[model samples]
Target: MVSTTTTSTTSSQTTRERVLACMRDFTSYQATRVALYKEFEEL
Candidate 1:
């Protein structure tokens, strides 16, 4: 029973990490795009 509980907790943590990573990646992409656009506008 304890092993099952541990497995479930580990799965949940893994899912959370994946979600956070995706969010970080999306944010980085948006930031880069904005920077590029700003540079182009300045030119």
Candidate 2:
């Protein structure tokens, strides 16, 4: 029972990490896009 609980906890942690990573990537992408747009506007 303890092992099962540990396994579930690990899975949940990994899932949360994956979600954070995806959000970070999405935010970085949006920032880059906005930066490019600003540069284009300046041009």
TM-scores for every predicted model? 0.74, 0.78
Determine the C-alpha RMSD for candidate 1 after optimal superposition of all C-alphas. Answer: 5.1
lDDT of 2 by residue, 1-43 (tens): 2445467788888889999999999999999999999999999
Winning candidate number (TM-score):
2
Error of 1 at 42 (Å): 1.0
lDDT of 1 by residue, 11-39 (tens): 88888999999999999999999999999
What's model 1's lDDT at 38?
100
Candidate 1 collision pairs: none
Model 2 misplaced regions, further than 4 Å:
1-6
